[model samples]
Target chain A: MIITRRTFVKAAAASGAALVLPGTAPGAPPAPVMRAVPSSGEMLPAVGLGTWITFNVGDDPVLRDECAEVIAAFFAAGGRMIDSSPMYGSSQPAIGYGLEKLGRPEALFSAEKVWTSSAADGPAQIEQSRRFWGVPRFDLVQVHNLVAWETHLETLFAMKADGRIRYVGITTSEGRRHDLFEQIMRAHPLDFVQFTYNVVDREAEERLLPLAAERGMAVIVNRPFRQGALTRQLQGETLPAWAAEIGAGTWAQFILKFILSHPSVTVAIPATTRVDHVRENVTAATGPLPDASMRDRMAAYVRDL
Target chain B: MSEWWTYRLEDFLLFSPRVYWRLFELNNAASWPLHLLTLAAGLAIVLLALRRPPGHGLWVAFILAALFAFVGWSFLWSRYAAINWAIAYVAPAFGLQALLLAIGGAARGSLAFDRRDIAGRLGLLIAVVGLVVYPLMPLLFGRPWSSAEVFGIAPDPTAIVALGVLLAASGGLVPLLFAIPLLWLLLSGLTLHAMGDSQAWLPLLAAAITVAALALRRIAR
Candidate 1:
C-alpha cells in the first residue's frame, strides 16, 4: 500500500463522493448559513471560491481534473458563490468546465465580472460569457477594477431589469482612487463590491469594508492572501495558539478566519491550485469565528511578526 | 555556459521584477551592485542576439529586456535604469514573453492549439510554479520563532505540512509535469508578497527552472 497522505485522501475522497449529497452535508451543521443577500434576499454561503490564478490556465486533463476535484470538494463542503472574471485569463471557462465535468454546477453561485475597458464592449462580453458558460442567467455581475463604471453600471442595471443577471456590483483593488469608489457606493444600489483586503492591506477597513456593512451590501474579498505574499510570510513558523482560539487550523485558515471575522466582510475568496487547499479553506467555514478583539489581536500578531 | 541567455531566464525573473524592486527598497536603494550586473546581462542579451549566431535567440532578447527592466536600474549603470525605478518589470516581461511566444509559434506554425497542447502549456506552468512555490516555503510560514525554551507545543501538523512543502522538490517527471499549475498560481503569490505576508523564494527557483528547461529544450533540438 502506498499509504501516502495525499493518496489516502484522494482514495477516501473518491469513495466519499459516491455517498455524499449534491449540496447538503450528511452530518455537518447547516454549513453556517449567512444573512440573505440583501438585494436578492437569497441566503448565500459565507465562503465563496476565488478563481484568480488557480482557475486561469491551460485546460490539460490534469488541470481540468484538479479543478473538477476542487469544485466538487467546494460543493460537497457546502459552498455556492464562485467569483471569477474574463480578465482572470481562463478562469470562467475552467470553472464552467470543472462544474460540468463533475455534473454539479447547479450547486454554484456564479458571480463573474465585466472587465472590458470600453463601455460598448461590456454587454457583448456578458452575453458572450453567458453562452460560453451555457448558463441561461448569471447570478451576479460586477465592474472589474472600476474600469468604466459610469457607463457599464447602467448597462448592468438594464440586464438586471431584464433578469439576465440577478445582481450588480463594482470592484477595485487599486488604492489611488478610493474616494471615487465611495462616491459611487453612496449613489448606487449595488449588491456587492469585491476588492483586496488581507490582514496586511487594511486600507479597506477605514471605509470600504465598514461602508459595505453600513449599507448591508454583501462584500467579497479578493486577493485575501495578499496574492500569496502573506501566506509565504507565515511559512516556516509555528502557528500561534491564539490562532486556534479564533478557529484557525492552518495558516490559511488563520488568515481567512481573520477576514471572515470582520463585521463588514462577507466572503474572503482565496484561490488555490490544489484540491487540498480547497478542503483546508472550507474548514474555516465551520462556525464560531473570531470576535472583534480577536481580530484586533490577529492584526497585532501579524503586524508584529 | 552559453554566451546568450537561453530563452527568458534571469535571476530577476526568478522572484518577479516586483520582489527585486521591493528588495531594492529594503536595502534603502543600496542593492546597486545587482543592478550593474543586470544592465550588463541585458546588453549581453541584445549583443548576443544581434552580433552573434542568430538561431532562435529572440527569446534571449526577451530575457535581456526583462532583466534590464527587472534588475538594471535596481543594480546600476544600465541605460534606462531610472525608468524601471518606478515600475516593476512584471507587466513588460509578460508582454515580451507573450510576443516572443507568438512570434516563435507563428514561425513554427503552431497556430492551431488542441487538447495535447494543453499538456505542454501546463508543463510550462508547473515549471513556473515549482520555480515559484517550493523555495518560497520560508515565506509561507514565518521562520519558527527562535526561542530558548519549547513553549506551547512545537509546530502544528498543518504547519509541518506547510513547511514540508518548502523542501526543494526532487528532480523528476512529477516536478516537470506539475510545473504549470505551480507557475500559474505562483503569480497570485505576488499578491501575498505585496501584502507583506509570505517570503517565497519560489520566483527565483522558477527562473532557474525556466533557464534549465530552455537549456534542455535547446540541447534536445
Candidate 2:
C-alpha cells in the first residue's frame, strides 16, 4: 500500500465502484469534478481550505466534534487541498488533529509552509511542517509570505526536481511586496504563488496574476474576505440576482466565484475558524464561476459597494 | 517604537537612493519584523507626502515627531533586547508583534462579541491550538532543515498533542490573554533551554516579545 500520486490516482480511477465511505451522507453531496494540471497531470480540487486563523477555533469538545463533523462534511461534500503555515501559528496541527480524527489524512492535498528566513534552513523547515501535519509526502511546499524565499525556493526547487516535493511556491498575503513578488516570478520557476486578491486588492490582476497564467503557475488566493473587511462591508446585504450566473447563493460563493473566474487560479483558500464557514467556503467549488464579462460586472458590483 | 526606532525610521526614509530590497531572502522571520519596521518608516514618508516638502512643513514635522513619539514609546516599553535575529531570538519579537497587531486589528474589526464573529474568533482560536501544538513540532514530523536529511530526522509526536490541548485550554483561560501565550512560551523556552543549546534564549525572546505585544494589545483594547 505504498502511497504516491501515481498510485493513488490510478487507484481512484480504478475504483469506479460505488464505495460507501464513512463520511458520505445518505444523499451524499457531489464531489467536484477533478481538475488536472496539464503539465503534471496531477489533479487538485478547485477549492482548498486555508488554515490560518482557524487553528484555535474549536475549544469545546462538543464544538471540536462538530468541527470534525464539518470536516467530514467537507470531504463527503467533495473538497481537498488544505493550506497551512507555521507562520499561521497553529493551523497545521489543528488540521492534523481533524484529519487524524477523521482518519482521512490521505485524502488531503496537504500544503504547508516554513517561514524561517534562512535559506540554509528551508529544507529542515519544510520537513518539519510535513512531519507536523502527518502527511506521508506533501503535495505542495510553499515558502510562506516569501520568508527566506531564496533560501526556501532554492531548497524547494531542488526538492521538486528530486521528487522530494511535488510542487513549489512563494506567497505574499500582505499585498505590500507584490511588485517585488512580480520580480521573483519573472526571475525563477515556481509551481505556485499565493497572495491576497479580494475585491479590495485587485492589484494582483493587473500584473502578477496574468503573469502566473502566462507562465502556467497555479495561483492560490488568501484573504478572500480582506481579513473580514469585505464581509463586514457587505453585512445586511443581499445577494444580487446577477450572482445567479456564477451559481453563487451566498456572499461567500460570490467572492470565491470572482476569484475562480480567472483561468490562472488553481484554488482559493479562505481561512475560517468554524465548520459552517468551512462548508460555505468549500461550496464555491460546486458551481459555475463568472466569465470575463461577469467578472467585470462582479467588479462593478463591488465598486458600487 | 523607541528613540532608536524613530531614528531608524527617519534615516531609512531619507536615506541615499540606494535602497536594498530583498524579497524572501536569507532569514525570513527577519522579513516580518523588517516589514513592520520598514512600513513604520514608510508611514512617515506617506505622512509627509500629503504636505508641501517645506524644509519640514508643519505636517511633515508633525508626522515625523508623531512617528518618533509613537514608535519610541513602543520600543522603550518593550521588554526584549530588540536585536531580533532568528526564530529563537527574533521570531518571537516579529511573530508576536504580528500577532499583537492582528489581534489589535481583529478587536478593531470588532471580531470579538459579534454573532457571526464566531468564524473569525475560531480562526484565532485555531491559531492558539497551533501555538499549543508548537512544542510538539520537533517531536512530530518536521519540516526538515534539509531535503536529503528528511528521513533521518525523526520527530516525537507524543507530548505535544497533550501539551497543545492543555495549553489551548489554559492559555485562553487567562484574564489577560498575553499571560497565557507568554507564560506558555516562557515555561516551554526554559524547558527547551534546559534540554539543549539550540532551544535557549531564542524561545524566551519569542515568549517575551509575545508577552509585550499582548500587553500593548490590552492597552490598545
lDDT of candidates 1 onward, in order: 0.56, 0.53
User: Which residue window of length 10 is worst by lDDT in model 1 chain B?
Assistant: B148-157
Alpha-carbon DockQ of candidate 2: 0.02
Q: Which tens-of-lDDT digit does each residue in B80-193 have in candidate 2?
A: 111111123432433343344234323322112211132223323333433343334334433232211010010111111111212212222223333434554564455344
Model 2 docking category: incorrect
Give the Å error, residue A24, model 1. Answer: 10
In model 2 chain A, where is the ten-residue run with the lowest total lDDT?
A: A15-24
Model 2, runs deviating above 4 Å: A1-28, A57-67, B1-221
Q: Give the top-scoring candidate (lDDT).
A: 1
Instruction: Estimate the TM-score for candidate 1.
Output: 0.56
